[model samples]
Target chain A: MNDALPPSNQTQHSSDQDKPNTPITPNTRRILLVCRTAPYGNALARESLETALAAGAIGAKVAMLFLDEGVWQLAQHQKPQGIGRKNHSAMLGALPLYDIDTVLVDRDSLSKRCIDLAELGDFTQLIDSLQVKEVIADHDVILSF
Target chain B: MTLHTVNKSPYLSQCLADCLDRVSAGDSIVLIEDGVYGINCATSETLSALNKAIAQLMTLGVQFCALRPDIEARGLQTTSANCPFNLLSDGDFVDLVCEADKVLSWY
Candidate 1:
């Protein structure tokens, strides 16, 4: 697993440098995207990811938290062969490309599901349930999917 | 006021119920996706419970609405006389989001 620190400095600089003279507005809301469902059973997983990407694209500070059945999204070697849906596992890897580096998975969620930390991708951090509450309190907007 | 969005059906999930419990007076609720199903005024066990909860919340001055596109996609009607929610277009949805102090989306 890659334990490298996120390159947030570069992303923040790039997003801000373009509009140096512009005053910061309330419109630039900090968003936390909470994923509570498993990846394939519904459209929520994909829609949440798209929302995060869209928020990040518009230079909003975006973070994602995985809870409950959402930890299944971090499982390795997923192949939705018969599911007739586009595989979104690779899309998680693309979060950093959109400058969405703060990906979190609940510790209790992973433990309850018997998911190993190694099974998750390198970009995700394992946070406790209390930290999840703090994460929610830290963001200006919360979107659950 | 907060703009709350519920995208899960109340009959299928406890999301709408939980959201209703937490929303303060003057907050706006926008039902989207499968949540538009909660707009049914039909008399059934689940629908009755949902209607009761919505009526109670409305008494507290909370505003309720559903996305027009999602309601149409689900083949559900949201008339002012029967339904507790108003219809919001895509543009109106954006306006509501921007007008609110914060957005809380419940799935």
Candidate 2:
């Protein structure tokens, strides 16, 4: 954790400090949520999705990039119930409802894993390694999960 | 038999080689997560030596398997006639863990 940045909750209310009585202003910063972990085996994947949803709810301009094992979260036909966990892919389908429309998937990560677009559905913008650098450069704030 | 699991990419970490050094002829090795990238064309001498070590271990009766999901996620083809290791499904991975006397993870 970097000491320079405030915690998530603090960042959420940072805009309201000057006008305590007023409602929090809609966030204007462009946030890129970078997810790079596999789902089910750990909590990072779920935590990253929750963070994205939270930021989106605050009216922040949010986009998501699924890289490395993070692409596994987008895989279809996931039946996590046997493992006593909710279906992560189903949760991802809710991103658009939260106004997180700019979901990106690393093309190299998917191809390296043998996953085709059909397996991941049609919700994301596929980006190559170079485009990944461009997308990062385009964002104002990057939150890795 | 021991089951040694490697989950870090050999290109970026020392986990695979360290695991290789510790594995015996009868121990089993299962590549998972980024470790599955080991099957890709070697990009360094260390990786080539690791591959050679894996092959030599196989000749000495060491069983090697890579997780099917991780392998497929990385788009690696283990079904080819010349593929070096076997692919294990999640259930099979569970079985491999149960069959081994001990399990060591290098991640």
Candidate 3:
């Protein structure tokens, strides 16, 4: 069985020192959080939101852009209240308060889903697919969720 | 003139191997999504196999890249934890695009 290997042994990730602290200090470092899914679906989706919120709270200049299927996350008039949830809709509203104001929604995705901005609240911004690559160009860090 | 993107996971094998198999040796592979999970695994034979394939590709001049955020999101910020791969940001991703003749998504 010497040739046999374990299941956990995978590829190599980055070093620990590269990880930032809980309160990421805003330096000249620019970050982009790519939100490609709706909220409350999986851990990654929530984690991406948390990272954006945390980064923004710490005065980090961050942008939250949604593309592909992610456009559904910012839909207007969410009523998860019936599930006895925290009204994620409200929590979503807090993004701007936390300085996570730069929200980008793909225009093509909107047309694909037939989503209307009038339904999504005034906080959301619609962008085209071409602009996304350009936007990613300006950031120092890109976090795709 | 070539971009290095890594598809280190078999899950994306179709996304990459399907469309990317036709790509010449100069193309790159950037591991994102479940791709970054390869960091510091539990000594699984699968990890070893993936690493071997990656090594072969590297020898052939295929670039392998692991997105920074994907690694961090998995709480792999421990650096010395498990998997060791290159890091790239959105700006880096953009620079790659600018460097490459064209960019294709595996998944």
Task: Point to the candidate with the largest TM-score.
Answer: 1
Which candidate comes out best when scored by lDDT? 1
How far off is residue A24 in model 3, in Å? 13
Most accurate candidate by DockQ: 1
Estimate TM-scores for all models. Answer: 0.54, 0.51, 0.52
Q: What is the TM-score of each candidate's chain B when compared with the real chain B?
A: 0.88, 0.85, 0.65
Residue B2's lDDT within candidate 2 is 63
Better of 1 and 3 by lDDT: 1
What is the DockQ of the complex in model 1?
0.25
**Candidate 3 chain A — worst ten consecutive residues by lDDT sum?**
A8-17
Per model, state how many residue pairs clash. 0, 7, 31
lDDT of 1 by residue, B1-107 (tens): 87889888888887887566556768899999998888764334645666776788788899988899998887877544666688899999999989987787786
Q: Which stretches of candidate 1 lie over 4 Å from their true place?
A: A1-27, B1-103
Chain A superposition TM-score per model: 0.81, 0.81, 0.74
Cα shift from native, residue B72, model 2 (Å): 40
lDDT of 3 at A103: 82
Which one wins by DockQ: 1 or 3? 1
Model 3: residues with Cα > 4 Å off, grouped in runs: A1-26, B1-28, B31-107
lDDT of 3 by residue, A1-145 (tens): 4235453332222334356663444554678776655666666566777898888777778888777666777776777767655555566677878877788777877887888767665677877755765665556666767
Candidates in order, interface RMSD in Å? 4.4, 17.0, 8.5
